[model samples]
Target: MTVAVGLFGYAVAMAFLAPRVLPRLTRHGVHPNLGVAAWLSVMTSVLGSWGTAVLIAVADAAHTWLHADRLVLSGLHEAEVIVTGHEGLAAQLALLLVTAVPAVLAVILFGRLARSQVRMRLRAREHADALRLTGTRMHRHSYADVVLLDSAERAAYCVAGSPNVVVVTSGAVAALRRRELAAVLAHEHAHLMRRHPLLLTVTRGLAATFARVSLFPVGAREVARLLEMSADDIAVRRHGREPLLSGLLALSGVAPAGALAASGADVLARAERLVSPRTRLRRIRAALLTGIGVAVLAPLLVVGAASGLLLCLI
Candidate 1:
């Protein structure tokens, strides 16, 4: 019964929490949350099963220690009690069925959903080469080869795989001055360099599989945001802050949809933040907080597992 309760609890936790936690972690730049959540869920299920098995073993051992005479006497008395009382084999079976069925269903549904997303991503990659549009000056970067293409509408896209390519439209190109253009390129390059898209895709797939998956989409988004800042830093260092800010302002006026534009929706805000005197301090504080949070959570999780194991023994 305790094993069933644990399984049910774990399934409920995963089904309810994975989807929400993953996105939040991704957004906050917390990378470890997803792994921790997955590990915890799996550990909970395994420990729960093991605990039940141990309980049954212990009960059997105790019965053996007590001998056959007690068993026979108790069995007759228990039968009589069951005839007069509410609890019986039927009630126990019903309880197990009620708990086990939902747990099994939750696992099955979430697993299938995650698998389907994986298959879709894999299939999307097959057509990546065919989706190529024409462009000149494929800027070779550590993360990806970015090409500037002529298109009526502005667009920026990342093609996944080895030697990943980031394609930008001519409209996007003509929209920014030289420095802004450089900043744009740097941003896209950072995305490739960090392998953000692939990580996000995998994380999403995992999150879909388990409802409690954490630090995937949100982490990906935060990484995307930080990489942009990092690239902006590079651009500022190479080209100067004025040019980068100007480029941001100029691009902000003509940002594109469905593309990582040189100007994103929050470019002005980012530009403002960059020039802010306290930005560096904030960055340092954020980093320190993240580190401290991870340090604290790691041990708590370990202790939780040990406690769960101890419960199983009892």
Candidate 2:
């Protein structure tokens, strides 16, 4: 009963409620990073609870159903159920599903994680090769390694895996003034110094493994956009707004795989704020933080309540 309830609760929330709650977080002015963290915490916690429930059910089945013909119903042993094939076929099928789904989910999660790591390494290497062949090494930025590509597509991007590489296309060099180029480089450096690549990779793993869960997909995208914004903030501090804004306008191409680029459509929304940066509203920030806290704790609440109720009924 405990296992059944936990499975039901997690599935329903992941498939339904999570999707609804995520957009609400954005509406409430939740910072993207905080929202991502909350979604990750909640999704992982629910998986944890579901895995525990499945293990308990499987162990119970192994000991009582396969090894013995009957189950002992606690200390008194007054009430009991048949544990072997004597039970109805429905009971056996339920037992099989209860034990199998969690294990399958675990396998799928690990497989996706391994695949993502492999893909990231390959992407990092490919970016390094592309830059080395088509680009020239430039004076290293204060915080990051740099390469300058001789291309006409206004692009500036950085990949921060083992072979960390930053590439700036010549188009950007020509399009952006000196200050703007410096600002763009600073933005890419911010990505490396902050280790945004690793963050995105982890979120990517979660998103791939739990694609059915809206939070995971939403969180992954939110993290990507937030990392860009966070880097923008750093660039603003380093060289003020105009340089960064100009660079952003000049270089608005898709970032290469495993790279954080200078401009994205997600950033277009931030232009107004660049002209007149306003303080984050305290109340909204607090509310968003609180929402994150609740998301982090919700899985525990669901499993705990289910456990309590099942215990009472039993």
Candidate 3:
């Protein structure tokens, strides 16, 4: 009963609120990292409910198996073993089917993650090779892993892998003022230092899982954009507003394919934010949003615990 309730509640809440509420949470102009945190929390809770269902289903199946056959406990050693109406077989088959769904989904999810990691590694290696030939080592802003590539492309991207190198194309180095370059480099390092790509990959995993069903992916997409904002905030603090804004406009969309670029596609929105940043969210707003996220997550935790109790009771 608890498992059934959890499943029902999860479905209704996601179907009704996720598409709208998640976007609102992520779209808020302040503290984008906090919004991403909320998104992870909500999605994790929903995922927990799915796991609870699987466990409870397996337990119920096992309990039914024990009760459905009287002869096993009837003290009739000579009696023929029988399952009336073949309910035992049906129960086992249902359990198998229930288990198979999550199992298959897990395989696919991890396979995708592995493939993505490999692709990123390959891209990093290619960048490393390019750096060897046409690149000159530069004074590291934050660290010595920085390199300058002799290319006209207005790009500044981070290669996050074994080497974790940050590359600045010659065009950007020539075109941007010292402070502008500082802001761009600062932004990319924020991505590297915080490992924002892994965050994005995790969000993509969740998005792929619920791609056809809910508005969760919208939240994930918003999270990606917000991550960029998070980095922008860091850059602004280090080099002020103008440099970051100007650098963004100059190096916009110059990131190579398969690279995480500082000034990627959302140039206009980022530019606008730099012009007049949103009023930093107040503690009240933060508390309120945190409460809402906790509210959404709490039900799943309660339901999971209740389902576990049901499993043990039977």
- Candidate number achieving the greatest TM-score relative to the actual structure: 2
| Ranking of all predicted structures according to lDDT, beginning with the best and ending with the worst | 2, 3, 1
Give per-residue CA lDDT, model 1, range 1-314, as digits (tens): 33334434543454345446433333332222333333334334433443443444445434533453453443444433333334777854554455455556655755785676677566545534434444664566676667766775554555564556677778767776776677666666655665545544554454445434343334334434544555566566677887767766655234322223445535655687568754344554454455445434533454466557756665
Residue 44, model 2: lDDT of 64
Give per-residue CA lDDT, model 3, range 176-226, as digits (tens): 999999999999899888878677766665666667646567766777788
RMSD of 2: 3.5
Candidate 3 Cα lDDT to native: 0.69
Model 3 clash tally, residue pairs = 0
Query: How does model 3 score by TM-score?
Result: 0.78
What lDDT score goes with residue 265 in model 1? 32
lDDT of 2 at 245: 89
Task: Kindly indicate the candidate among 1 and 2 with the higher TM-score.
Answer: 2
Per residue, candidate 2 scores C-alpha lDDT tens digits across 135-230 of 788876655558888778888988774457788888888899999998988888888888887887777777887786676777777667777777
**Candidate 1: worst 10 consecutive residues by lDDT?**
26-35
Candidate 2 wrong stretches, greater than 4 Å: 1-4, 7-11, 27-32, 66-82, 88-94, 276-280, 310-314
Cα lDDT for residue 18, candidate 1:
40
